[model samples]
Target: MYVSLNRNTSKWVVKKFEENHNHVLHLPEHSHLLKSHRMVSEAQAINIDIAADIGLSLKASHDLLSAQAGGKECLGFTREDQKNYLRTRRQRSLKFGESGALLGYFRNQAAQNPYFYYAVQLDKEDMITNIFWADHEMITDYALFGDSISFDTTFRTNKEYRPFALFAGFNHFRMTCIFGAALLYDETVESFEWLFKTFLHAMSGKKPITKGKRMQDNGTLIEPLNQTTEHLLSPKYSRSIIRID
Candidate 1:
């Protein structure tokens, strides 16, 4: 199932940082990053059913995105088989080629499991849209296929973007997104949210961090129900009004 979002309807969706300006650092090359997260770290198929799970319609999704990005989705909610590879991912969890082995981790997995096809397509927006095949047997043909990635951009020549990271964790497994945040000095939630949602995946850990402001004007004087990220990864570090879904 494909969900399409047009301009100014649903207020939840945010473009993947790299999809727009590169916010979350989600890939293996930058896996060394200690703070952020990404989704497409490696080539994989996009789970489009995500929208259905989230109670979204193709039109509703299109509207949400169009509103969030303030643009029109030319190809709204369309499902087509286009090959895309995964891009960004988490820092601590990523495992690279074992080296010296004729068969690799991806190969073995492809040989065994059929849930995640090796050959997949990721849009410039970092969303998976296609796969080599929908089921197991057909995908085996691509398990050992040479990886091909398309890193697109000419706008970088201008100083409008910088690299950033967006991350989230589930159970014990963390996945980063590729095509992440802008590599710049000052950070913005717009960029962060983008990278955050790519690997945002399915059900998550906890509530999203909210705006830096408190509930009361003299709120600082009173005990608070929530906090921020200071010495730890708590709620206090968040600067936005509330976390974007």
Candidate 2:
């Protein structure tokens, strides 16, 4: 506010009552001064690419480049600029390597195992939907001590994000052993059913015999035992269902 006397009446009067509103936003010093690379030599660019391909650490690569430049500054460039360039180059290499590499690996593994059992489900377009496998050793273990099988589908790996299921059970040595595994694209009832059936088929229709069950029904649960020299019938399964027992 400002007060002054009128020129003709010689009286004091208020000129303005509101506070000053004019202001300007101020930035910090050197805000616009970005230290950027003005020029990168062709030899320096080539050295950077070579060091990155050899899997050198970013700091080490920068230090080597610095030493090559005779202790001179990076021609207005910073270490961060060189690091970003290396990262982009490495990512492009990984993208190209991922194409068809994983499937080829699986095929090679299948070829090496003569008695390897594998199943693949396809979609309407004939693309692989799901795949499962059990090796020869796994089948032998199943035939020997195939009781109390436990299956779990709680793992995922690789780019496809497929759920990996493992069929595990205890052996005669009282140690956990894997019988089979499956890579499923989705978690559905049909997928689970097919997985269980495939596991049973791989073991040559041999169901693990159950030993103990407290039943209220008068009917008996009989299990076939004709695998070896023992012809004795084994007691398996409950009166209500026809599951693994």
Candidate 3:
């Protein structure tokens, strides 16, 4: 019967038998009194879209709908149902590969601005390990106000726990402007050296006069930058560190 029985029919039979047994035992089946949740409608679908656009989470949207007068009874859907719908929509929207989605976004940006610069590094597995990008405006800003630049790598941006490093400088307007940014696979000396090289390459081999970076720890902070700075200060590079503290 496991393979031959219709699942819906078997469930119905079991439910009916239980109800009948409850009746025979003078027990009330409270199922009839329980409220049934309603299905989402077209209007609610539009509302969901708006809510998603506004960055509301599934649970937040569901709670918002439930709090409205007679909303839960009229909409009839629970938070889990909304969450399921959101998952379905997201899956459908991301029909292509996840990697393609990010690369496509960058491609679109480059299409709009021809001067956008970007570089990516892949691991041994050929998966994206690091990416560095800077726009033409940032390059222009760096040319004008690249005297003092700062580097900081204290944030983790993904599940891989990669450190996000930002190369920023102050513009003529005295505004903190980003020259370039990188995601390092690790905070090792090797990774930092590569990032510094890549960042210089992105900025057309222009090294900042004052390269200030936040010191997070005794070992990890200055050593990597110092090594890279020393390498760049070589006569071949024609770059020299005026001061180091």
Candidate 4:
């Protein structure tokens, strides 16, 4: 197909058209796989957001949507499309900067729940270096099942590659429960010190009786935990134990 501009009418007109094709046409069943036909509709976008909020992976979310739509061929969008959509949404959400957006979100949560606690650590340049947050439910859970808590920093965020730490324990039902979470700039003793202190403050200074850490190199983390214990513990709980696994 070709088009020409008609100066007299200031209009573009199709100048040439060919009935013969250069390649075989796509099958009707595969039409949805074409770029022109693939799209993430508004409803699908909402479903994707809900799925993400529930911690669904991109592939899982896409597969779920495909199942709902009867089959992958009827889903109208590919997993890559879903990934691009979510990526774009995250980029747009951080329009004001990631730190600012994070602070805003924390503030909003705190507003809704007065028991919500969050602390941000800044470097010498006043840039956010570490962040910790725990909601009211988490605080309550900690008060109940925090006697033996585990801390792990092996997980990392996909985009930032920052250490994503979790303060977790088990409920009476033996199900895993989260007490708090943090995003650390580094795995340094200073970062861990700040995170542990902030976590204790959020849980009303109730130090875990036994704190377990999962790390291959426990030397760096042990120092911080010991320092935190000495600084934050009362004489009555001075015998708190630290375990490494």
Q: Per TM-score, what order, best first?
A: 4, 3, 2, 1
The residue-by-residue lDDT of candidate 3 on 70-106, one tens digit each, is 5554456666667666645543333334434666777
Q: How would you encode candidate 2's per-residue C-alpha lDDT over 146-202 as one tens digit per residue?
A: 755655555665443347877777887889878888877555555555665676787
Q: Estimate each model's TM-score.
A: 0.18, 0.44, 0.48, 0.51
Highest-lDDT candidate? 4
Name the TM-score of candidate 2.
0.44
Give one digit per residue, the lDDT tens place, for model 1 in 1-245.
23446568754454443335447645654452323332222121233234334646446654554464344332222222111111221110112221112125446765777453333333465433222212243222222220211111112212212222222222213222121112221133333333323322311222233223222111222222334311112122442222223
Candidate 3 — which residues are off by over 4 angstroms? Answer: 1-100, 211-218, 221-245
lDDT of 1 at 7: 60
Pairwise TM-score winner, candidates 3 and 4: 4
Candidate number with the higher TM-score (2 or 3): 3
Clash pairs (backbone) in predicted model 2: none
Error of 2 at 159 (Å): 5.6
Better of 2 and 4 by TM-score: 4
Best by TM-score: 4
lDDT of 1: 0.29
Instruction: Give, for candidate 3, the lowest lDDT window spanning 10 residues.
Output: 231-240
Instruction: Count clashes in each candidate, considering only residues at least 3 apart in sequence or on different chains.
Output: 74, 0, 1, 0
